[model samples]
Target: MGKKDLLSTEPYKGVRDFYPEDQAFLNYLIATFRGALERWGYVEYNASILEPSEIYKAKGSENEEVVREQTYTFVDRGEREVTLRPEMTPTVARMVAGRRRELGFPLRWYSIPNCFRYERPQRGRLREFWQLNVDIFGSSSLAADAEIIAVSHAIMMALGAKQSDFIIKLGSRMYLDTLMQNLNFDEVQGKKLLILLDRSSKMPAGDFERELGEMGVSLEMLSPKTPPQDVLDVMERLKMMGIENAVFDLGVVRGFDYYTGVVFEIFDTDPKNSRSIFGGGRYDNLLALFDDEKVPAVGAAAGDETLRNFLETRNLMPTYLPPTKVYVALTSESLVKEANKVAETLRQGGVAVSVDFGEKKLSDQIKTATKHKIPYLLVVGENELSSGTFVVRDLVSGEEKSLSRDGLLSFFLNL
Candidate 1:
């Protein structure tokens, strides 16, 4: 092939290729997510990225625009339509229903899954990203909704975020439905008003009012009223549990049609990056698509890209340290074998170690180690080989210590 015809080095637009530092941050986010979820007794779950397209088409799955425009759908060789999952709720519901007879009640599950969506890429929105999905199944109580929100709060706090850094805005589909009933609006009018309410925050005031008027609803009829008692009760309960940042927001109509009860979105309070970090809500009837009976489920999903942006805005991103705790440099080409031996010994002692090849000069090797941010650098030379001792240099502190093999092992073990 001609050089000009070679493939481009850039990744597909709207996706990312994580280099070491990027991957380190991603790993840190994933580890923090997994740790927080597991501490709450939530088990991990996963499934194939490809699913039958009908799963999303089922009643109350997602909005029509998502299935029609955003989803990556194609017909496979089997003459059946397949879709790269745009979200996890539908797939998880299918799995739970398929094994409902064998599984126990109140299943607490979580998954960090990659989701695909074909949308205009913006600051917080991406076509491809990883999301941490946390769900609890077979719980109908309002406490389950509070617990899911609690888990969301816990994840933010675990990342060294304070309550002031973000706010949780709670809403309810049932509450909205009741409001519509009181106003004597039919289902068609109610649905239109919801779409308007969901987009109200982004619309100009005059434009929003005109749209509502076009739907035959007056501004006076749909003014910002006090939150209903149920929402207030939930807010009080959350505050009692130390999650003091939650409040009622009538505008939080989640895009999914499956959400039947309380809904919420966690928003970053920073004006520069002001947006919903992640959100999920009660979809008590989602599993009904697969089973005769419905399962009461409440869950939420947080995107890693958006979470990283939130951390950056707050200056809370974790430091990226090299995975190798120690780097061994050889004084001469002859000591290559000895350096490898020492590295192997440290590995056996449960320390992460790497040995430099003899092709590079000792100074160059130390520079490479420092570039990687390795914590310690050990030099293997004739004196150390004969004296059964080595000088370990602390890269961060710039201190040198003479240590035997046992002492070196003890140092890292203590760390």
Candidate 2:
């Protein structure tokens, strides 16, 4: 070897390379999410993955680690610093503010955007992931909060998940703020307490208590037996709407300081995958960062990674079916044109068809179709072309049917 090759087959350390099977599952999850959101009159929206670096630096809006370390930021050719978005909320807020007067109030928008973060990858946490961000803008009512939660519940149910599959843990930044004030803690102390409480679930029991003690706060103050009235009202409203899984859990501070009111997180109930599937809360002031008038908003983001984990743990993942419903295999090179014609007829009848040239043996072609999991296979030979009829075999079952041109069109149309 004159020169050694230095190329690596691995994807970037923290990101993913979604092969066909992985992409099929991702598409299924996205379709399920889109259907649920659209049923609620939520229109889809998207933004460029690149944004100015300052967007993440907005006060009280993002996690510090996201800005200082996790973000993929670099100076472009023009010497302007750009960053791949670690989240979608700031960009969505910017869009709303840019056309605040033009857009209708109480707008429902949803997007499935890939976000990047430079962090240690674990079971559910990845460096790169796609998240479904659903939000209702320009609504301050607790009903808006409840509707957001309801949409999240709807997505779970749409994916064949039962009510018992997950639990909605409700919290309130406003309630925590009130408690801090009542306890005579200042803003700095309150911020520290919120960060601690947010990490409490992941921290060990003794270490968590010790940190709170060092900060002059006690565990009882954070996890009161009775939840605050607003949190209770939101949970009750969700319950009234037949979402029985909603409950109050005071430990959900939602990491971001911008969450002003009711916050909620959905957790997988299975012990094996016991982690947060996704969560969001009321960020009434996020829009104010752009304009003087604040548009009260509540939204939730569900990640494909965590949701897939939940479905896999519960055995609810959908079976992958190849997009091609029928594969047309040529019996020999002489019949390639005839096979193409047959595939065209099937396509005109609204059937997904793939034509295989006769490079491989006919038996090998059928094996390829079977290996791809295509449900139906049609072999076009000289006799079938001369007779204007073909045999279609169901790959799943060993069932075969002979049909004329019109009959073949009707068969798939009926299916």
Candidate 3:
């Protein structure tokens, strides 16, 4: 028999397979990340996965280029053209525009979304992946930018990340345009240069030179790489309002037309990974493209799949998988509801409790407890019920403690 062709029948590439182990860990990771975001006062929101193709086309955003270049777009049976969202900003913008009048100033919205793009899948890249999108609408000040970056830092720190793990390489749309316009470059030429500049770090110096030369750029212009001193001095004053670590990089054009100013890229500071982790910037022109009032916005979308790999590279996630703090067990089936009642009571005390509903041997119950890493198991049965007392077993320490019905609540609360 001849070798079969892949397209004839095969699983789609660039998707994921979440086995049980992956499911458990992913749940824990999402919980930890969301907990951090919520602490920053960012409310969760979601948008439709399918959006009109023109939504991206209007501002000529990077995603629009990707839509023409890499999106998995198709026409519906009704001939309605739709595309899977490659990013979330435009969808968010559409939602904002619909209710812009009612929405108060400085809206903070976040979403963990599954976005798609059709392209060559590689390590740290996938066609389908989840991202953490942090957006601040109606704020144009540098304080908002600082808060965004700081929250990103906080999330990383909460997830056991360190400063040295990544570097925030900042740039400004105003700075870039001011320099390019100073060189007498028109908007058309400036955009071409930006497309080239976006690859500055990726391509070798000679390749970068040739690529620019092919576009009528010169070696001398590329040599004095960053913006001139006076312009940078002004931006430095502007950047001071942000966190001290934010830097001005001439090479960071952000590859998105919607970014009007204060652009930045986040790169891995560790030598092992030098790629950009994520990028975002202020976009003041996007809403204007919709004929809606210009609403200044800034946000970032971090690829969770990419970040998972980065964290895994650094062994950054917590171990032991957030062990169950409480497990309520019915030593006899007769005490099912009682065990559940005690479990609920303990849970209300801010403890994580699991109830055993299976009719199994007590040994089987203990085995289940040890297997699931439930450190504390609460036992309720006839003798304990009649006496208004309870038995608790600490699986790891092999210690059993008994407490009165009144004391059970305090016992678990203290643990």
Candidate 4:
């Protein structure tokens, strides 16, 4: 049947439905991310999917853009404008600032949660997704930035991605601002120019050139889109300051207006499909907008939808294809109960085993077991039941043997 004819269906387009195989991979990927976070000495926390609009507005932010631009928003029963959260950092900052007095200085935390963003769907980008957000709060030193970068690099590495498959592109707002100063960039004009630059690779060269023309640039074209100066001068300073090769790109000025210090993004090395795999930066002023103090913060989040595509592109997704390990078939009506008992024993031994209680014939049962990729099919027939044992048939090897309870357990234990 066609999907539209159904009474209800999935409404979201840039979302997914993960079944057994995909779920297995998802679980594996999440576990890997969690393990890496734990090893890096980070604690886990969560924020509600809904947040008050005021939290965003306090820092010269727009709930309407989130409501009208990026998020799934609606008027609640009380008619207050509430939004299903499109990101976690803003909420995290609110929670930290609210309890700032009680929490210790420099809180290290991580969260793996569902996030939403309404954008044009494509490979590596989606509206509904899961992301891992790691943060360091109350620290202003460069070490905090380094630790965040290291943790992000570690997560990518854990996912079977090599240094060549991914690159950590670090751009400091401090550094970028310094370069702008050298070029006499208007702070107002630069912001517009930066917005144009963000779309440089996304849109066509001709369109970007035209937009630059509108921005009062006398030069029709720019080398790498930053005219009147060599690109390497700014990059060379970063290299001189000991920034790793993992850090590149002077053109990355992230879209979020809150970033105040060192900022970084992870990008796939594939030039053709190169998109930011993840991005984050320090926002020391976000909390100060609400309170008296400048509460410093730095964090990063990687959407798994994007990360998954990055994995698939590089053939680095976790291998977690699922199948049964064992099946116990009741070959005769008299042996059915014993077959259940045998299956339970195998399960207790940490073997994934299923028993046949269906009315299918013995031949059909065998076919079903094989169809599910069950490795071993145990046939507990009347003859075997009388002998206090069962026939263990290795589905792959096609070898049969008479094995007692102890022998079967020992055999499975070895496997």
Q: Report the Cα lDDT for candidate 1.
A: 0.88
Worst 10 residues of 4 by lDDT: 226-235
Q: Which ten residues in a row have the lowest lDDT in candidate 1?
A: 58-67
TM-score of each: 0.93, 0.94, 0.77, 0.84
Candidates, ranked, TM-score: 2, 1, 4, 3
lDDT of each: 0.88, 0.89, 0.76, 0.75
Per candidate, the number of residue pairs that clash is 0, 0, 0, 0
lDDT of 1 by residue, 163-248 (tens): 99999999888888877888788867888889898988889999999998887777765545766666776787798899988988
lDDT of 3 by residue, 1-415 (tens): 5566434443489877775556676776678768988998989999889988888777665556778888878899889888999888888888888889898989999998889989789877889888788889998776676667677766666777676777777666776687677778887888888977887877888998888788666767554566545335434654564434455566787877888777767777766666567678788777775655789998877787667777887888556543468777777777788778777777787778888884998788888888887788777778877898777888989999888877877777676
**Per-residue alpha-carbon lDDT of model 4 for 1-415, expressed as tens digits?**
7886767666569888886777777788788889999998899999788887666655553344655787777789998987777888888888888889999988999888887778888877788888889999999876677677778878888899887787776666665566567668876776777677677768887887788777665433233343213223333444444445454454566877788777778888887457788788778888875678778898998888778778888887765534567787876666678788877887887888887884779889999887776788888777776787767888878998888876788888787
RMSD of 3: 5.0
C-alpha RMSD between model 4 and the true structure = 4.3
The deviation in Å at residue 110 for candidate 3 is 3.6
92-120: candidate 2 lDDT, tens digit per residue: 99999999999999999999999998889
Q: What is the lDDT, from 0 to 100, of the residue 35 in candidate 1? A: 96
Could you give the C-alpha RMSD of every candidate to the true structure, in order shown? 2.1, 2.0, 5.0, 4.3
Query: Which stretches of candidate 3 lie above 4 Å from their native place?
Result: 1-13, 17-44, 61-65, 106-108, 138-147, 178-192, 213-220, 223-244, 320-324, 329-352, 358-361, 379-391, 402-406
